[model samples]
Target chain A: MTIENYVILRNKKLTEKTFELTIDAPELARLSEPGQFCNIKVSGELIPLLRRPFSISQVSGTEVTFMIAVTGTGTGILAKKQTGDELNVLGPLGKGFGIDDTFETAILIAGGIGVAPFPFLINKLKEQGKEIILFNGARNSAELIKLNFENELNSTDDGSAGLKGNVIDLLHANRKLFVNKNVKVFGCGPHPMLKALQDYCSTGNLNCEISVESNMACGFGICQGCPVHSASEDKYYLICKDGPVFNSRDIIL
Target chain B: MSELDFTVKIGNKLTLKNPVMLASGTVGYGNEISEFLDLSEIGAIVTKSISLKPRKGNPPQRVVETTGGMLNAIGLANVGVEKFISEKLPFLEKVNSTLICNIAASSVEEYTECVKILDKYKIIKGFEINVSCPNVKDGGLIFGNNLEAVAGITEKVRVVTEKPVIIKLSPNVSNIAEFAKVAKERGADAVSAINTLVGTAFDIYTRRPKIKNITGGLSGPAIKPVALAKVFEISRNVDIPIIGIGGISKWEDAIEFMIAGASAFQLGTINFVNPKAAKEILEGVKNYCLQNNIKEISGLTGSYEL
Candidate 1:
């Protein structure tokens, strides 16, 4: 968890609110794991105060790319950045996935911007020859933000675009495939979406993992502010510490 | 007592030269404002929460400013407990300030597991159990809302260490006083009030939410009134000491918390907006005592009638 500044190599719009940024912080890129994130320093003004946290969308050779949305001052400033501009980044912080052979079948569920952390996970799992599925949920087909993954896995769109309704609805619509075992479920997104995913996987008895979001001032595990409680099961897990990613059973969701 | 003698104790064992502290999460482990903060000048330093593992937190677009306050979904990102014990604690030890490691847990088990590592330190003066971070599902506000959880976890952690345990309570509740009373009865040494209120902000022009997460916990100068009111309610309900927190930006704000029955104070939200605000407060406390011909600062605590 190194806290340093990275220069923006490029910023391009992928959707109305979504954009992709390439940063020059080699150390952050080098250390980055799929589920981890960087806290972006607010540029040009100090009113925003603390940095914004983002899961590592993708990591390439000398640069790292994050699929970001222009939501507030912190990210709006980040979206507006040009090449050669210095953007402060503190990361690659948090735990990501380990491409274990034990997971024969893996599924990734992402909600809106939550789709950011999975592309790297997919590529990693592909090396192990593990089968993958992606169920993405947005308001509609027009709202679905897609990443150019090298043509792998089953893609489900919640809107009438590619599929219909919610991605979980599509999974339920295709529930017969889950009758088997040895499946690990990975999900990232809004609280309710994660809860829904947790329910579907648990009822289907699929092993599941999820990455949670929290408000953090330090990218390091210093702020107790990003606290999360596991369901009626074990205990608590920090979104910043124990996981941005956790076994679906590890948490209540 | 001289005006300077106004300082009082925060917990049973932790006595402050002044009764004000920078809340965990807001102060960033006392490093951000060491020169400006004079870390030793305040009653104590309540550090941000540390966990058993490292974290990455939320995705991009985690913070947004609301009407009177700001919303943040930063999900406590940290270097984990062992790293903090070695990396950050030593620096805190070097400073004259007594370190109260602020701890957060998602369950009765996680809180104990994380705090158990702290038991190994032997140097931390106290522990602040943060039961109210809005972003995490099991960790923050959930545990805070339940009375059984408030006492159950406090009692579980109480047996582990001899040091005082200060439970930091959440503000986003219909019954904050109920939570405070539970902490006092169960075995908590003191109770701190008003973690950030749950909130959200939007870009009206875009007609979309300002934060990518859609909703966040509100903090900063705007929450002072709500904090003062909560502090007042909980203090009246519980006999144990109350550490008031929320939007404490100035010495006057600190005084308001005291009168509201906070034996001590935590400066939240403002630390980032104004780095030197804590110093401004200490000086102001000194000046106010002198101007009012008040000798002890503790005398200001609960001076407000209603």
Candidate 2:
């Protein structure tokens, strides 16, 4: 489902650069799947004309929330949006994570604000009665979003949090946790972290899926802007349409 | 208030429900944005340019947001003519608006061959001759700039198809009216003015070009004024209808183009900012006609006074 010009229900600061915005898009919330994202117009003006894409973080009834990192001018303006401010949003775009009863254990990995798409995935996975083990990493403790996951572990680059290393390092240190279980890995983070996770999973011959990010204009297949090298095919796949999520073995990473 | 007539005829071959269209390349082959918009709201959907063979387009960073506009060097990536007929044309047929196929090639023969294959399909309402693309290695800007090349291609396509043939002109020319006159004389049904102006953007930190092509076509509000001026010049030179394109984000922009002698308008860069902008502008024009007591939108065409 796609909703345009939805009003913001909440826009709050999570950290210095990271913020959260909840829009009142009931149709989008109902149709949204984990790993899918939304494209938001930063402002009404043409200077910052292109809409920025954000992964869906949480959904509650008519409200859909996004975890945004103020990276550039587009996001900086988005972060400044206030409650009751109307924004043009088109969403539930791209292919989402393949979550089903096949995998008994879901090992979720995130780096920095890559944690944005996981909360909703966790919520859905929990409802399916799957074992959830979340591995999250950020620059520091303040950068990490607070969530309720009893089996969660974390790392911070500055060593100001649970584990004093990157998320991949934390995952590497705790390899035994994924050893004998019927586990399926799901990851979202910076490219390096996803690459590291892909290496670890492929090396062990484990099943894994990952969410990919690229610079995109239309959050649909049209512009052909966001492309990831296809692992099997010689052609490139659009991250906006083919996936924000793909099997770790299916993409070149 | 009396109802205002929004319908318009293009070259006596096709009559569109309205004058506002979603320009080629901006709106994908009528299917990608279907979920976000109502296709019926638009007068026509011009599919992205297709060539005789498939093109992979340019490398990443194909698009970059600039001040009040954007730059794109897509290199005319497409599935070729055959795949478009098989894969894309089916989806476009389901759309409610007129379907205009935009064709581009490196040579006159390639353009004619591509159109010959497309000419068999009745789903296409018209053909938009795309000769202004700047990203191609050859024949794009070359054919559109040279009078003989423009006339040769226009006459070739005109001989092959009975459908309306609209020539897309480049803005980088010294005197655009001369080119428009050539296209008009060669049997072009209408003219869609001012394809993106060739420009380049650089990242000061890395001292590297922002686009992989090193140069790209600039579109958006930044190019609107130039588009309007060229459209006005072309309108004065030729009696054919002009489809004004570039930086049109609102109904008022459409009105400005219509007043300047453009019979219709196409929304380009603004589609990236707001997918529904074309539909909004179409509705806005209708409301403008109703409030102003205008009987026909064509009445505004060339209505500009000194």
Model 1, A151-233: lDDT tens per residue?
A: 32233353456566666776676656555757788888888888999898888788878888876665454444455666653
Q: Deviation in angstroms for B282 in model 2?
A: 1.4
On a 0 to 100 scale, what is the lDDT of residue B214 in model 2? 89
lDDT of 2 by residue, A1-253 (tens): 4757888989988888898999888889899999999888887787787888899999887888999999889998988899999988878899999997498999999998888999889989989999989998998988876565788998999889878999988988888887789999999999999999999999988789999988777778777777677788777777899998999999886
lDDT, candidate 2, B194-297, per-residue tens: 79999999999999988889888999899889999998998887788899998998889999999988888898887776777787888889889888889998
User: Considering only the true interface residues, what is the Cα RMSD of candidate 2 after superposition?
Assistant: 1.4
TM-score of chain B of each: 0.95, 0.98
Which 10 residues in a row give candidate 1 chain A its minimum summed lDDT?
Answer: A150-159
The TM-score measured for candidate 2 stands at: 0.94
Q: Give all candidates' CA lDDT scores.
A: 0.76, 0.87
Which RMSD values do the candidates have, in order? 10.2, 2.1
User: Could you give the interface RMSD of each candidate, to one decimal?
Assistant: 6.6, 1.4
Candidate 1: where is the Cα deviation over 4 Å? A1-253, B1-3, B205-207
